[model samples]
Target: MPETVFEVDVDEDPEDQPDPIVNRWHPDTPPAATIKPGEKVRIECLDWTGGQVNNDDSANDIRDMELSPNHHLSGPFEVKGAEPGDMLVVDILDLGPFPDHEWGFTGIFDLENGGGFLTDHFPEARKTIWELDGVMTHSRHIDDVRFPGCAHPGIIGTAPSHELLEAWNEREQALIDRGPDAQTGVNHETGDDEPPLALPPEPENVLLGDMDDDKLEDAAKEAARTIPPRENAGNCDIKNLGRGSRVYLPVFVEGANFITGDLHFSQGDGEITFCGAIEMAGYIDLKVDIIKNGVEKMGTDHAMFKPGYQDPDFSDYLVFEGYSVDEDGTQHYKNGNVGMRRACLDAIDYLTNFGYTREQGYFLLSTVPIESRLAGVVDLPNTCVTVSVPNEAFDINIDPDTLADDSVVTDRSDVAKPS
Candidate 1:
């Protein structure tokens, strides 16, 4: 076992833990631990929400989640010779859920909260809990499916420089000030016609690990939230970034203050639900190396990574395709977002034929290892997207040739909903 530089008690609130677990991103936040380049290390992380959601039968936690304090990251672990303009190379060696916490969850936030990609179609709060048995996972909330997980860290990145952080704040705030986008659906809380355009810095519930008291007040006000992926790759949520993957992150501040959290047992492409993936509290084993001036060598300003070699293989799939057409048949020009939503909706509709509710189908899609591909984009009038589910995921035959019927899943059950 590699030495664990930073650890956490899963049973305790993240804010109350002995080591400071920060929610916001700031270059000034002190490093909680340090590691030398080329040395192997282990780091434990809280789930993105810091265990606020529980292993229960209700979805109230998803509905009423406090979104401000989130993505509780483990460290800004300084690398011994790291400096600005270098690329911090992170190799994800191994990772898994805590032995006592071998279970994980996936949820859909209500529209008033963050809401998901398909929130307008399925606007209520829902949840599914999966029991992890080695690499395979099965859920009680959604029936008739079992699949191997692509276990990996969902969020990881280096701290941003002050100039870059301010650029993020300014552009994102400008979008927020313009109000919600008309094409993005509605924000139920504000009664706006669109969901939130962007999340800005909020001082409430800010946790800066081991920083001085006087600087805490000022830092919290300007610190960037960890919801969206920026140049530093804060929360990209790429599922294939598992064991054996190598990430090259641009070092903005001295020491390459790398922080990470939001581990997932498995997630389909897109993580359609805002709270998608089988979220878990877990540990990641890593090895670091600094490519001195690698940022200039690569000629890329943003983070880059090689996909992990050991992803599960599923040869057979039932692929559903969608075009650049809205649900209401409104025509749009090369809108890939609209096309992808239609593709996901089509998959949910197909699952209903096997006696699963639309909600169950949506929940299942989020946790499974499905492939979502952008099949076409360059053609002028319409863009194409496809969502393909592995045929082997279900016990019964669901291939197109078999012509699936409701006989497979007779004893249908639904996911837990809010009271």
Candidate 2:
């Protein structure tokens, strides 16, 4: 086993851990540990919500979930000799759920909290608890579903410089200032007066690892929320970044205060639900090395990574296609977001033919290892997208060529929703 540089007790509150975990992104967030360039270290992490949601049958926790203390991160581990303009190379050696805690959760946040991709259609909170057996996952809330896990950390990044952080604040706050009336050109799923265009720095419920009480207040006011992926690679939610993946993240601060958390046991392409993925408390084995001045060498300012080669191979798929047209028949030109949302909805509709409720189908699609692609963007006014589900995920035959009767899945259970 590699040296365990940072260990988190799964039972302890993430904010009050021994090394402490942070939610907001700021350069000043103290590092829990410092690692040499060539050292391999094992780091433990809490789920994104810090145990706010539960394993039982209830969606109330999700409906009333507090947004501030989310994506609870594990470390801001400083890499010795890492400097600005360099690239911090991270090797995700391995990852998995902690012992005796093999289960994980996926949720659809209520519209009021931070609605999902299809919040307009399904405007309520729902939950699905997936039981992990070896590398496969099966949900107790849904029927006839079992698929291999593609476990990976959902968020990982280096610290931002003061200038970059300021830029993030100004740009996001400007979007928030635009108010809901302004459509921002893209037909996003902000369904009927939804959450802000961009979440700003919130002082309430902020936790910066090991920072002094005196400076905490000022830092909290400027720290960025961990909701969206920024230039530092924060919260990208890319599903292919599993074991053996190599990420080249651009460094902006000295020592490269790197942080990572939000581990997903498995996730589909988009993580369409805002609180999507089979989220779990887990550990990751990583080896770090500094690529001195590699950002200039690569001619890119953003983080780049090579995905792991161990992704499960599925021989067959059931494909659904969608164009850039809303469900209400409103047309839009070259709207990939709308196109992808339509594709996902088309997939959910097909799943309902198997006797699953719309809510259950939506929840299942978020966690499965499905493929979503922007198949056509340059063709015309209607960009086409596809959502493809692996036929092997279901026990019953779902292939259109040899699919069973509509009553194939007779006994269906709905997802856990609030009363």
lDDT by residue for model 2 over 1-419, one digit each (tens)? 99988878778787668678899899998899999999999998888999888888998888988877887888899999999999999999999999878889999988777788899888888898889888999988998899998899999998899899999999987887766644442334554554567887889999899999999999999999988998899899999999889999999999999999999999999998878899999899999999999899999999999998878888789888889998999999999899988888988887777788888878777888888899989987999999889989888787765544544655687788886
Where does model 1 exceed 4 Å of error?
181-192, 404-406
**Model 2 residue 359 lDDT?**
86
Cα deviation in Å at residue 118, candidate 2?
Answer: 0.6
Q: List per-prediction Cα lDDT, in the order shown.
A: 0.89, 0.88
Query: 355, model 2: CA deviation in Å?
Result: 0.8
Instruction: Please identify model 2 stretches exceeding 4 Å from their true place.
Output: 181-192, 402-407
Give the Cα error of residue 204 in candidate 1, in Å.
Answer: 0.8
Clashes of 1: 0
Against the hidden reference, what TM-scores do the models get? 0.96, 0.96
